[model samples]
Target: MARRGPKSHWWRTRLLAIAIVSVWAVVTLALPFFNSISNGTGPGGVGIYVFMAEGVLVLMLALVFWFARRQQAIDREFAMAEED
Candidate 1:
């Protein structure tokens, strides 16, 4: 059995996290600008929106992790065969 280090997929994990946080940040920053024109539909406040986005981000990140791991496995196998 080969031992793989956590760093193998850490970048993808961190990217997913950053994307989640960015969603919250963008919504929070844009709400004020959007309100200046007309009402569509948005979070009442930043705090609540953060909670909502956090949930979405977490679910999405889990899926990202699943896919990334599968892809990594395929890549590792191909690399090993190429070395032979």
Candidate 2:
């Protein structure tokens, strides 16, 4: 039987970031375009400061979670390698 590889690979993190970014990009970028086309200089539906604060909070949360998971994975790997 083949042993399983570590879960926290770079590709996994990158794919996650790409997915989050793609969705965020599509929503943030396209909404304005459609709104402008449909309503002509629509209210942008946003307060810039609130949007900026929320975006930063979400990004920092993701970063912190990722960091914690990575550290756990590293510790697990170190413990396993030492056992061998």
Strongest candidate by TM-score: 2
Model 2 lDDT per residue over 1-84, tens place: 213454544445566567666756765676546555645333544554345447656865776687656645554554433232
**Candidate 1 local lDDT, residue 15:** 71
Location of the lowest summed lDDT over 10 successive residues in candidate 1? 75-84
Q: Candidate 2: which pairs clash?
A: none
lDDT, candidates in the order shown = 0.54, 0.55
Give the Cα RMSD of candidate 1.
9.2
Which parts of model 2 are misplaced by more than 4 Å?
A: 1-8, 40-84
Residue-by-residue lDDT tens digits, candidate 1, 1-84 = 223455645554567567656755665556546554444345555554554457556755776676656555644643421332
Score every model by TM-score: 0.36, 0.41
RMSD of each: 9.2, 6.6
Give model 2's TM-score versus the native structure. Answer: 0.41
Question: TM-score of model 1 relative to the true fold?
Answer: 0.36
Per-candidate clashes come to: 0, 0
